[model samples]
Target: MPIAGPWIQLAVKPTAFDSDDRGTWLIFDGLLQAAGAALLIAGIATSGGDEEPALSILPSAGPHHAGLSLAGRF
Candidate 1:
């Protein structure tokens, strides 16, 4: 059986996050996610509303390889 672990993330902005593993990162995906989050936060904040930094749990590498991303955002 494949053991699974939760997705780990480091937030570059509210509503965005990054993974330490290469699997989740498409070409420029990380930059986009971070930038998008930043923009979203900035937009919301600038518009005068409540915005919170959020992290979404992406489908992640299973527990067998869990520690692969344990060192924090790489």
Candidate 2:
């Protein structure tokens, strides 16, 4: 894939539409993939390979919901 593959997909997303004229799902796919790849690259670039990234996971709850609260520093 090209370095700008995701961006290219997003650029051409408009023309990928069908006759229904709905917004292209490729835009979301491209954006999400791009964001994930960026984050991965950032993490790899910032890590020294010896120091582990800081992280904390705590139980979280609300009136009608409960989930894990994740916090971290990379």
Question: Tens-digit lDDT track for model 1 on 1-74?
Answer: 11111123223233444355443553246566667778867775663435444544444577575432323211
Q: Highest lDDT among the candidates is held by which one?
A: 2
Every model: Cα RMSD to truth: 17.9, 6.7
Write candidate 2's Cα lDDT for 1-74 as tens digits.
53466567556566654776334555566667788889889877887677778899999999999999999877
Model 1 segments more than 4 A misplaced:
1-27, 48-74
Off by over 4 Å in 2: 1-32, 47-52
True-vs-predicted CA distance for residue 11, candidate 1, Å: 16
Global CA lDDT computed for model 2: 0.72
Q: Would you estimate the TM-scores of all the predictions?
A: 0.30, 0.41
Each prediction's Cα lDDT score? Answer: 0.45, 0.72
